[model samples]
Target: MTHATHTPRPTAETWALIRDDYRSGITAPVLAERYGVPERTLRRRAALEGWRRADAPTPSLATPPAWLRPPVSREEALARDPDLAEVDAAEGGDRIGLLFDPDPRHLRLFAFRQASEAAAMDRPVQAVSWMRLAQIVDRCGDRIEADGRPLREVDHLRAAYLRRLGELLPEDMPADDA
Candidate 1:
């Protein structure tokens, strides 16, 4: 006996389902499992619709919870965790860089420790700016530039990540990776 193959036809509802799920920041794998489809199929559908998630903010960022708001200062942040203050103290005016990986339901908050002088110069330290430092580290290693001139800014044990990034990054990294 011979078996006949039939092509699967997609409906408008299918596209809407995919678009809605993606817009809501549902991962392709999660959506595939929910809809009983393969992950590759979901990805293909997303690509076909020109629904690129490269710049879309995760749901957590798009709708942040009250507690996830950015802390105003390093002191306010360290207050919640005394150990952080201790580490800061131990560093003795040197900078510290931290990379956080939060749960899917939450946003990952990156932070950097700056010397009081450095903090005063650039108030309102931003987490995005900190990550930019990481990118610079990855791209240029420990050495960087200052005021359009080359310099070394790595040595996390001694320098603030932002100061390094500011000295290195050509201009400025985007605030929203979203």
Candidate 2:
């Protein structure tokens, strides 16, 4: 005759502690091991109780930055800026140019913003690609703006890149203000 081992269900206080730890960004597996519960059990209980990680961005915070937001439709863009209607008609009414022109400075700024967003979302590869694009645009812009043409300082871009680098590789890069 073999005796089966039995584990007691977690008490209310124990469950509360588990929930708190989970919400505080502790992984379910780690919490399970620490609290003497099965990983699946902890995850299931947290799901049933609608537990949200504290580090997760809220809905408003998750919204893309204004510069990254594209116009929903050509009609909407035209409606907002009636002046663009002429340009739209000239471009066959299909391509409604919203915001930035074909300027290298604008392109660089756009790329930098995209890189920043990718970094914020923990997408290191994408962030790096955008950063590279930004660098290329900046270099091209420099050549285009040769002969003492006035251009905005790129210190902000450098600062942003450093911040993103820190986000991607915390140990290698120093932290800076966003």
Candidate 3:
């Protein structure tokens, strides 16, 4: 007859270490090393416990941190600043993504909506949205300008949606040579 011995589950202290380290944005292997737990075991425990990143709060939650929540409707957005709303809506319909998307076109579209929503809150500027737009422009400005398609009534206005921030800066325009 062979005798069998069972391995004990991780201690609560270990589980707490795993959860806290994971919440602090530590990698599983690094967390495992720091906490003296096996990486696979820590990962399995994390998954079993339903641990998730809290980098951004969800919008559906009530009063979800004013900075974290943008206005939910176009009417609400437009009521704050008619110009941005008009220029922004010209790009497309109202839609707020639940996450940061990398596609330039999507980012550009999201920039307009985010800025408009933020403006509706009566801020001098929507810093993050402008930063995102700048990033999109830096990433794909040449492509957008050369693609030679329009997203608004006037070809130039297609991208001039950004000009709402300024009183018609020349940089917000496409070349007239088109």
Candidate 4:
């Protein structure tokens, strides 16, 4: 069996009305009455145009949405929850590796540490290090280029990472990697 799809072609005026009255809580029946068109047709056209009722009450800026609200301080949170305080107190033993947070500073630190460890293990850190440092360079590129030239800022960061690489790796590491 072949199924045929019929798409309703709305006129300019109807489109303008659709755009204008979209979130105005005007039902299809009301729109049909006002536009002298069938309620089903208006609904079909609205569906085709991907219009939705914007009836949800917008939260006031004076009182932010819960997620956007500032979180209480770590100490305050811990004070309220004793179990959390216990966890904070017991933060160190076997969970050392578990605490490897991937935040920007930690990410770079991790790369540096990995480079150092890889060199100790007699494995080159080149393949992974370049990609990781490139990500950092790209993320901070906008801020780094404030003094005019872009390549200079990237080169400076590259030089710093390269210096760390030199410090960690054997002196025989290829110079062209710079």
Candidate 5:
């Protein structure tokens, strides 16, 4: 005769703590390690029980919470955080031009600036998105100019940029349609 080994189930109190922690934005892996439970088991339980993380947006809500709403105007935003007022004033005409301008150089510069800001904020994914936007702008060949007018030789410039992009990209990256 052979005896089967079984893992003990978590006590009600322990399970409650796990649920609370998971709902409050603690990752399943961290909670599992803290409570001596398997990460897979914790994840499965959380999924089955519909454990919504505190940081996640609730899809079922008819109207989002006030904190999720954007400020109505720049004045309202500045009122909320007075520190932004000086930056806003300094960027006034240039910021408006950045939004309205279709110039590829300006767009590329804007994308690079966004990437830098996102990187500084420790948001790698957002930074990568901005960098990709910059690359897209560069590859479009709208930056090539002759006598202050965009050059008609766009196809050649685009082909060259695409070749450069392929060289810079990792071997495993998906091929772009460009």
Candidate 6:
């Protein structure tokens, strides 16, 4: 008769080394070499323990930092569930406005109900510091309105376009070019 022997589980010392090194931005390859374990084993253990990749930051807790100072402070976070904090945590920092460039032939005004709506649907977009018609134009190429009107730039964009237009347009206006 033959007896089958079971390999001993990793010691607490091994687990501690894994955690400490992981938080300090050590790579799995390095950890594997130091611990004499396979790289895949280290990664699998990290995954099971909810350790995130080195490049990503840990999600915030149920209650945000007091420093957040939400523009519209409700009693609770918008999601209202601590478990969902992971999702919100990924969206750390302030809100942003995303601009979408529809097909060249399409012409739609800014009619989104909420910023989240645009994010929910993956669209060609750019985040703008301020949500203004002119700001959108500055970020994207010039666009004409559906009514065949050339939408003029506003404020900063106006100056930029005027300079660009000057470079493109001739100084002398032809009699028929009026």
**Model 4, 83-155: lDDT tens per residue?**
8866665444224543432234444554565566445544554536745775675577556545454245678
- Which is the leading candidate under TM-score? 5
Instruction: Tell me which residue pairs clash in candidate 1.
Output: 55-178, 144-151
User: Which window of 10 residues has the lowest lDDT sum in candidate 1?
Assistant: 101-110
**lDDT tens readout by residue for model 6, 44-95:** 8887787866776877677764434343333365547667566555433222
CA-lDDT, candidates in order? 0.55, 0.76, 0.64, 0.63, 0.79, 0.55
lDDT tens digits by residue: candidate 1, 111-157: 23332334444443444465555455545532332222222344443
Model 3: weakest 10-residue lDDT segment is 94-103
Ranking 5 against 6 by TM-score, winner: 5
Per-candidate TM vs. native? 0.25, 0.31, 0.26, 0.25, 0.36, 0.28
RMSD to the true structure for each prediction, in A, is 18.6, 22.0, 16.6, 17.8, 17.1, 19.2
Error at 119, model 2, angstroms:
36
lDDT-based ranking: 5, 2, 3, 4, 6, 1
How big is the positional error of residue 82 in model 5, measured in Å on the Cα after superposition?
3.7
lDDT by residue (tens digit), candidate 5, 1-178: 9996777889999999999999999988899889989999998888778898899876666675444454257788699999998878866755677654447787788789889977765677889999999999798745342234433468668978999987899998777789
- Model 5 TM-score, 2 decimals: 0.36
Which residue pairs come into collision in candidate 5?
none
* Weakest ten-residue segment in model 2 by summed lDDT: 92-101
